[model samples]
Target: MDNSETHNQRIATMTFTSVYPLYLKKVEKKGRTKEELDQVIAWLTNFDEQKLQELIEENATFEKFFQQASLNPNAHLITGVICGYRVEDIENPLTQQVRYLDKLVDELAKGRKMEKILRGT
Candidate 1:
């Protein structure tokens, strides 16, 4: 009932981190294949806060996310060729997305805790 508790609770349910769950719902409706889902998971392993925001700001359709997933370094083996066009400059949303994703993947590679916090983990 205190301000600190309320702030902590709000942070716990952050929408930014919820993007993965939202993507999960769309995966089935979008008719994604297992291979594609694998690509998605691989890309998610690379997800970081900055990249998630950039993707959203670009009004990046699921297709754009999928395209970027294909190029993700960690997911590249599964994604095969990198089809998405690259943008130079961190100011560019796409570039920022890629940068964050790369950082995220690096963190995961080190076996760091993936979730900042889960509802019931």
Candidate 2:
């Protein structure tokens, strides 16, 4: 495929949200205080998707990931790489992760097609 086609295909096929819940589960399992959880949630709320995409492209440091989580109270107890690259909870595996990502890809493709048709692209 040509470069543009390959690039678009990558964007269309890449999956990240599948692991988001896995990350959340790991965060929740640490028994963090409510304040700490809130802080992490706040960071998530304000998180910039584009910046995160850039970080992913640049090979985001494990330190950077932890720093993002550290903004919350009780962060002192949390030190280590986040989950999702590889799931720690083997009992539940990643079957759900793949399903969630597939759903997201479908929704996104539908939205993109809808937008293009609206704009007559």
**Which window of ten consecutive residues has the lowest lDDT sum in model 2?**
85-94
In model 1, the runs with Cα more than 4 Å from the true position are 1-63, 66-89, 117-121
Best by lDDT: 1
- What lDDT would candidate 1 get against the real structure? 0.41
TM-score of each: 0.27, 0.24
User: Mind giving the per-residue lDDT tens digits that candidate 2 earns over 23-94?
Assistant: 445445654333333333334223355655554565544334334432323222222222332222212212
lDDT of 1 by residue, 3-43 (tens): 25544344333433345444444454555433343343455
Q: Distance (Å) between predicted and true CA of 52, model 1? A: 16
Candidate 1 lDDT score at position 89: 30
TM-score of 1: 0.27
Q: What is the lDDT of residue 54 in candidate 2?
A: 56
